[model samples]
Target chain A: MLEPVMFTGGVYKHDLVMELVEDLGGYVLQKNVTQSEVILLLLVPKEDMEALKAIISDLRGELVRAPLAGTEVAVVTPTLAIHHLPHTACDIAEYLRRNGAKSNMIGLARGVGRETAQINEYESMLIDEHDAVVFIFGNFVECIRKKEFLYRNINIPVVVTGGPEIPKEELPYAFEYVPSVGRITHRAKKATELGTLDKIIESVGRALDRTRTDISKDPLTTSPPRVMDAVREQVPEVEYSFSPLPIALNLNGVRIKLPYDKHKDAVRAVKFDEGVTLGEVATIRPSKMKDYILVRILPMSETGFVF
Target chain B: MDPMEVFKVEIAGEEFGAKKYREIIMDILQDLGLIRSIGRLYVYVDVKKPVFAVYGLLRTGIPPLLVRDVADVAQAQGGFQIKVNDEEHMSDLLKVLWAKYGRERVEQPSRDVVVVATDTSPSDLPVADLEAEFRQDLTDALLRIAPEGFRNRRNEMTDKSFFFIAAEDTLKSELISEVKEKIRSMENA
Candidate 1:
């Protein structure tokens, strides 16, 4: 088993931590350097965790378990207008990012009003790409109940947030409902408000765990991290892409941040040491998010083998 | 404790919505610094009917800002030299001076000093109409306080009070009268 962990420390000797993970046959998922400080997201072998901890302690770096790592989450709001943004939506997205998840904030084009709100096909497709989604609603129970149609068609688990205390059965389509985080005009600073944010994070963590449990029943041919590492090494064009994380990981596969038309062949041509190409094990297609490429790895039932 | 003398919100069949709207109104009003200006506020939102209305009573007697209030006027070498005590109204003061005595006659020697060519003391000139500005900001705060889905809006302002209504559908005369009656009843209650 591989344990997901985050390391935070100064820039000096951060490479030693990466070296240690590499030596332990672990993968460094992401490395973020902000001025003199650095943040490393890694997957370390479970038995070798104590050795990595010893190295981190000697280097004086902080290491914490990141449960939401290697997954993508969507924070959906009614609209991108000032009424729903810069406060509630932004805080939720930022909190998810701090928990080691790649969160995308999606504002519905015409998702306003009690009766006139809507979600189009394109929007649904984009949100379906993530592992889980959190839909932020307003205070009214009638409005919350009425907005169920928005996420009913989504395949991923939907976590609904609002102001009032509504029963879970009220929203049958929602995987979970978190209350007390409705519309707000100010940043969440008070202890109670911060606690509400923590509740949201916990709910999202549980939602992701449920998905992870399902994925475990039928594992993929290869893990997403291994695919990410191979793609990064073989596909040199991904380095020139402006995206902070050129290759974003999900439980099923990794999203390569490059144009689909031009780089689909290169992404499919990525080879593994087991004499198999990526195209044989995964489906490479155009992503709903911009012109990027999305690769969904096939399960072992179809491939007849596991890496 | 509530800041307004009388604050009430009524949403038909939605107790949670009413309470949340009350907090939202107060938060938006306080954020815009218009809480003190409102003596009473009655908000009536009918989500089923899909209309929102706000009736507010404003505190009376906000005196306008004049030159004597913001600066010290005195006799000087060329003309009347006004030394501004409050730089907040410096730009307004300069504009007033230039309008009274052409651009050539008004000279700002320093950031706080303004000289007028005329011999008459420019002490009592009105630099800014603070009451009008306050009313405008209060209107903006009211619009923001209403829900985002309500696109059609109508605002009525008097010397001492303001009535604002917003609705998703077309706002009709009957709907306005119904909302006004609801707010009036809330005020009495």
Candidate 2:
């Protein structure tokens, strides 16, 4: 089993940590440098976690298990107006990022007012690209219960947050409901407010676990990380894309930041050591997000073999 | 302790909603530095009808911000020199100076100094209308304090007080009367 962890320390000798992870057959998912400090998100072998911890302690660094690492989560709000932005939505998105999830904040165009609240086809499809979604609602119970239409068509698991405490049975469409995080005009500083953020992280963790369990039953022919490696090596042009994380990983697939029409053939030609090409194992389609290429690997049932 | 003399938030069914909305209003008001200017505030929210109304009595009228209030004024060789202490309102001060004395008569010699060629002291000249600025900020805060779905809004401001109502549905004359009645009862209690 691979353990997802985050390493935080000074930039003096952070490369040693990276070298150790590479030697232990682990993958450094992301590396971020902020002035004097560095943060690394890694997938290390479960047994070798102790060895990694010892080195981190020697470097006086901090290590925490990041269950949501290597996953993309969407922090969705009704609208981009001041009423719903820079406070509650930003706090939730920042909290999700601190827990090691690549969070994307999405503001719906016409997602205001009870009667006029809507999720366009493009908005729904964009949110569907993420592994999971967290829909932030307001203080009213009636409105929270009525806003189910926003996530009814969404395929991924959605964790809904609001102000009041309502029974889960009332919201059948939502995977989980987190309360006490509704409309606020201040930054989250109180213990109770921070606790609610932790609960959100926990709920998202459970939602991703459910997806992992379902994928295990009909496992993909190859892991997403392995395909990510292959694609990164084959499609060097992907590095030139302006996106920070050029290749975004999902549970079942990866989103190549390259344009679909031009680079679809190059992406399809990526080959693995088992002598199988990507075009044979995965379905290549245009992403709902900005015309990028999306690849979903076929399950072993359809491929008849696993590499 | 409450900041305002009489602050009351009444929500029909949800007690928690009332309490949270109270904090939200206070946070927004304090953020805009308008809490002290408000003497008494009454908020009424009807989730069933989904209407939010706020009635507030102003403490006192705020005097217009003058150029001298934001800077140091002294007589120079050919003009009155202003050493701006608050750069935030420098643009407003400059605009006022340019309008009073023609553009050629106003000169900014340094980053924070403005020289105006006029024998009459520009100290008494109003740089910005504080009452108008306060009204604008209060309107912004009210829009943010209300729920996102409350699109249709009505704002009535007089010299001494202000009334604001927001609703998801069309704000009709009948709804305004009903909201006023609700707020009156809240104020009495």
Candidate 3:
């Protein structure tokens, strides 16, 4: 099994850590360099953890389990209006990022008001790109209950947060409902307020885990990290794309930052060591986000092979 | 302790919502410095009916800020040299000076100094209408304190009190009465 872990150490000799993981048949998911320090999110093989730990200690690095690593989550609010942003939404997004998930904040254009709250087709499709989504609602129960249509069509797990403690059955469309985190004018600093944030993180973790279990039923023909590695090696143009993370990894797929039209053929033509092209194992399509290319690895049931 | 002499919030069926909105109201009011201006406050929210109402008694008698209140005014050789003590109201003071003594006669040699060539004392001139500004800020705080979903709004303000209500659908007279009655009962309780 590949254990998800995060490594925090100096920038110097970080390549040695990456080389060790590559040699151990593991994947380096993300590398974030902030000045002199470096943070790497990796999926290391469980049995060989001792080797990586020894190397990390020698380099004076820190390694901790990152359960939400290798997955992207979307933090959604009603609108970008002053009422919903800068306090609650930002706190939730930052908290999720601290737990190793790459969180993206999405503000719905017309997602305000009780009876008038709505989610358009484009907004829904954009949120669907992430592994899971958390919809931040207001204090009122009627408004939260009335806003169920926002996530009814979303395929990924939807974690709903609001102020009132409504029963789980009240929100059937939501995978999990976390209460006591409604609108606020100030930052979350109190112990109770911080506890609410932790609850949200836990709910999201459970939601992601549920999706993980379902995906395991019919495993993808090839892992998304393997595809990410192949694309990175074959498509050199992706490096100059100006995106911090040129290829964003998802639970089932990876979003290549390169434009779909120009890089479609090059990405499809990417070859693996098993003598199969990437196009044979995954579906490459235009992403709803920023004209990027999305690749979803086909399940073994459909592709009839796993390698 | 409540900053206002009397502050109350009532929400139907959602005790947590009521408590949370109380904190949110205080936070926004305190952030905008509107808490002291409000003497008594009553907030009533009916989530099922989907209406938000705020009726508050105001602590009026906020005097308009005069040039003398914010600065030291003295007669100079050419005209009046106003030395601003509070830079926060410097822009307001400058606009008043420019309007009183035309742009040519008013000169800002430095950040804190404003020279105006005029026979009349500019100290008596009003620099800012703080009462009006307070009302504007209170209105903004009301809009923020109400849920974002409550789009349709009505605000009735006087020197002594302000009544504000917001709802999802087109507000009706009957709904206004219902909100008023709910707030009245909360005050009584």
Instruction: Give per-residue CA lDDT, model 3, range A262-282, as digits (tens).
Output: 999999999999999999999
After best superposition, candidate 3 residue A251: deviation in angstroms? 1.1
Question: What is the TM-score (0 to 1) of candidate 2?
Answer: 0.95
Misplaced by over 4 Å in model 3 are none
Task: List clashing residue pairs in candidate 2.
Answer: none
Candidate 1 lDDT, tens digit per residue, A91-162? 999988888889999999989998889999999999999999999999888889998999999999999999
Instruction: Pick the winner on DockQ between candidates 1 and 3.
Output: 3
Per-residue alpha-carbon lDDT of candidate 2 for residues B1-189, written as tens digits (9 for 90 to 100)? 787899999887887788889988988898999999999999988887878899999987788998889999999998799999989999999999999999999999899999999998899999999988888999988988888778899999998889999998899999999889988887777
In the range B60-157, model 3's lDDT, one tens digit per residue, is 99999999999999999789999999899988888888887789999989989998998888889999999999999999999888878788999999
Q: Candidate 1 docking: what grade? A: medium
Q: Which of the CAPRI classes, incorrect, acceptable, medium or high, describes model 2?
A: medium
Q: lDDT tens string, model 1, B77-98?
A: 9799899998989989998988
| Model 1 lDDT on a 0 to 1 scale | 0.91
User: Which residue ranges in model 1 land beyond 4 Å of their true spot?
Assistant: none
